[model samples]
Target: MSEDERATAEGMQTCWSDSTPGEIHASFSGHRTLCGKPVIEANPIYASRLGDITCSKCGGIAVFDEGAARTRVREVLDKWIAKGKLTPASATEMGNLAIDVFPGRAFTSRRKGHSWNKISTDFLLASGAATDKDASARFVGELGLAVFEGLQASEYQGKY
Candidate 1:
């Protein structure tokens, strides 16, 4: 028999099917030993992808489309600026940082090379928007929320 036939006889098999829009199908394959009790495990792909928008490896279901995320982040920053929580210049800086952090942008980079947290902190310091520790923490927390909302929104749209 051919290698594939042998593998099938040995209880190894693979299957593929069409996935919904904005998603991909992936599967795992491994050996299954009877005596040694070899184990095989598989997990469903639980993340969505659209163009450059996708969940981080560790982000699980989190996902975001580039344009929508950028617009959402900018709107949140604008609200903060209007409320006097952040200066216009600081808001602009934060908006720029968001653009860089989100996927589908040329500036997108992993946290290793360009960390969103570090960039937000630096922007706050340089812009003098939230120099105090408590204030800075709160500001960063707000940014985090904005990002989360953007991601969730994208995921919802991708599903339907």
Candidate 2:
């Protein structure tokens, strides 16, 4: 079989295992290549070592999340709080920007009696590269295995 055909066949055969803990097989993250011809992204960092996920049209970082905006605003608010930089009025203004700039993009979900959000594993799994049930299951299995293996490795290192 040809290379692409062979790769596809291999991917199809891979299965997730709940019992095992090291990457059982290659993940979609490792196996699949982005489709279409790639273009040069205008991002300052993109001009350097661009990865496969770079956008084909604009050569942008192909951000699935509003990570940059969130990080910047968070850092600013944190810095202001650290330096006692914000007056009551200024704090209110920056706080407004913080809430409005990345509305609905917050990684954390509101919890009972809590003002901040927590990470959602469900959201992450849902947004992964795999589209179908089977593919997703397999990917999750392989990922679980990888994580388990890493934990074991770390434990072993600590013992030595």
- Best candidate, lDDT-wise? 1
Best by TM-score: 1
Which regions of candidate 1 fall more than 4 Å away from where they truly are? 1-63, 102-133, 156-160
lDDT of 2 by residue, 6-72 (tens): 2221122222223333322212232322222222221223222222212221111121112333344
Candidate 1: tens digits of C-alpha lDDT, residues 1-160: 2323222112222222222233222222323211112234323223322222222321211223344556777878887788888888988888767644543221223323444456445545654556556766666656655664554455422221
Q: What is the lDDT of residue 13 in candidate 2?
A: 21
How far residue 123's Cα lies from its native spot in candidate 2, in Å, is 33
Candidate 2 weakest ten by summed lDDT:
56-65
